[model samples]
Target: MKYAWAAPGAKVVCVVPLGASHDFGIAIDTVMTIAEVDTSPLVKCSVILRFQERPSDCWYAAEAFRPIISQDDDVAMFKAIADRGLAQNGIHVPSSSPEHA
Candidate 1:
């Protein structure tokens, strides 16, 4: 998995993944999951990264989200998603993902 720095205090959607390399900076924070973009509908236990930890806000999107990231590693994860045509969009990686989602 690849990671980008998030600006301190910048709110982001964390994509918590199972059996993946986890982000060491946000391993024990609590976040809220919303079902919709503007709605605050509670979804699941979401974790937020601590601004004090790795405070450099950067959106982690599939290589499709160019200008933000690139598809370098063959197993970059985003590659497979792009292959399936499931390009755009990213999941919030809660601090609990086995690894950086």
Candidate 2:
């Protein structure tokens, strides 16, 4: 699941479990803003929240926040993070993969 399109003025929202609805809760919260579109298209941002269920519910999730980025920047950020993650897990990633091959 990818959400690398939360640009400034972009239409985006969060989904939560129902039944435990809240009367007072922030809907949209943005933590970080990508300054350079050329350097980091998918900038890392987080969301802090105080839920009604548990105190441990205060959590932060990293996101590939994109804001009016170019093709090169988009590809670069994705590829860089992909490479790092794969390499960290001792996995060798090819330049391209086959269709379910």
Candidate 3:
């Protein structure tokens, strides 16, 4: 499959059984804001819960709670944390087969 595009973009689509739906589509919009983050100890990335369209729907889940991400499935020790949360909230992540070529 080939896609013709003009700019770089990233998105994650979640298919849940039943729950409130939200998206950050405006992330690709026209906005040039800058800031600095203190990555002194280490840069552990995490997905933040935020409502980009509504200023009232924004806040940190915790002062320090980072999820571990990995390319290998065996390295997914922390993946179940989010998976359980989703499952309990009536969300289902479709099972995927290992890709081999």
Candidate 4:
């Protein structure tokens, strides 16, 4: 959930505010850049994101966005799925097996 690693071109899910109904949803966008503004004694940073479906840029706090699945995370998820498939087929997969040395 760390936004520090996010850079330009990185995909992120932005939280959208919904009023009254309290229904909240997320919008996926690509990171444009991080903007820093100096306010006298304080410096504020905002994440600039661009929507994929349209031509628009949104500036929001860094906390409002969450990183999408990373390459390592995808690999681990696929490995888990493969392990489950093997188990379902009566094949044994060691829980602590190393995929690579």
Clashes per model (N, Cα, C within 3 A): 20, 0, 0, 0
Looking at model 4, report the run of 10 residues with the lowest lDDT sum: 34-43
Best by lDDT: 4
What local lDDT does model 3 show for residue 65?
Answer: 25
Which residue pairs of candidate 2 clash? none
Indicate the residue-level lDDT of 56 in model 3. Answer: 40
Model 4, 1-101: lDDT tens digits are 33464665556565544122432223445333333311232326444333343334433455666667779999999999998899899998656757642
lDDT tens string, model 1, 1-101? 13242333334343443213655322222232222121123523222233233324522222111112234743566656664563344443334346755
Candidate 4 — which pairs collide?
none
- Report lDDT (Cα) of residue 7, candidate 3: 15
lDDT of 2 at 78: 96
- Top model number, TM-score: 4
lDDT of each: 0.32, 0.43, 0.34, 0.52
Superposed on all Cα atoms, the candidates' RMSDs to the truth, in angstroms, are: 18.0, 13.4, 16.1, 9.7
lDDT of 1 at 4: 40
Query: Cα lDDT for residue 44, model 2?
Result: 49
lDDT string for model 2 (1-101, tens) is 24455333333233432223564332443233322112234534442222223243443232322234568988999999999999999998766657645
Better of 1 and 2 by lDDT: 2
Candidate 1 whole-model C-alpha lDDT, 0 to 1 = 0.32
Residue-wise lDDT of candidate 3 within 6-81, one digit each (tens)?
Answer: 1122122222221224442333122311111222234343323332332544422212222222367434645777
